[model samples]
Target: EKVQLLIARKIELFWTRNFSEAIPYNNLVIGVPKEVWRNEKRIALTPSIAANLVKKGFRVRIERNAGLNAMFSNEEFEKEGATICNKSECFQSDIILKVRQPLISEVDEFNEEATIISFLYPAQNQQLINKLSV
Candidate 1:
């Protein structure tokens, strides 16, 4: 009976750990900053998408004026459960999503474990790549 109880406990532990890791989503904060590049007017993560993420337990933060170019107002995002914050606040998230590659100077604003998602041309921007690597 002792051996059977030990085996059952071990199986439960194993399944708990494995299944916990298998869950696809978490309550990670996702940040969306405005496009700062000249003539760049694109914005990532529309209000509808942000709302869907919120419904899925993710927190979405958008920088002020982030969606103006895309004709998306801050009120629209707020209505969809997003928080509109300053540029720096947007950088302090678990994930940062931008429409274009961020400037080298902007790389320092990222959180140590933050993941940046954008359209980067590393070949054309070695300096930016090096800054990001640091």
Candidate 2:
């Protein structure tokens, strides 16, 4: 039985390694940031995305208090198997999907190597882009 258990563990590791290799490194960690617009009740990605990410074997981390404005609670996100983290940690994810342009503080909160995905209204807020570029 001990030998069987060892074999099973090896098989699991082998499969996991293969699966991870098949998926691109960029696709591994996904981040979802909440829009900071005043009275903005819309959320870019909902719990549905979290569920989908879980099914795809990807890790999701959302900014704390981000979904509350949209009426989605932290519990809902957790129930969908998404990891709830602070703004700083969430910005460290490989990909960040956002509904609005990132705040200056939020941009500074990002991990230098992380990829940020958002609808940046550069035309409306050129100063923000300039600030971020610096």
Output the number of the lDDT-best candidate: 1
- What would the TM-score be for candidate 1 when compared with the true structure? 0.80
**Which tens-of-lDDT digit does each residue in 1-134 have in candidate 1?**
99999999999998777443433446588999999989988898899999999999888999998999999999999999999999998999989999899988889998878889998899998999888888
**Tens digit per residue, CA lDDT, model 2, 1-134:** 99999999999998777443455643688888767878887777799888987887888888777898889998899999888887777788877888887887777777776766777888998888897677
List the pairs of residues colliding in candidate 2.
none
Best by TM-score: 1
Output the lDDT of residue 123, model 1: 99
Error of 2 at 16 (Å): 29
Local lDDT at 13 for model 1: 92
Worst 10 residues of 2 by lDDT: 18-27
Candidate 2 residues lying further than 4 Å off, grouped into runs, are: 1-27, 131-134
Candidate 1 lDDT trough over 10 residues, lowest sum:
18-27
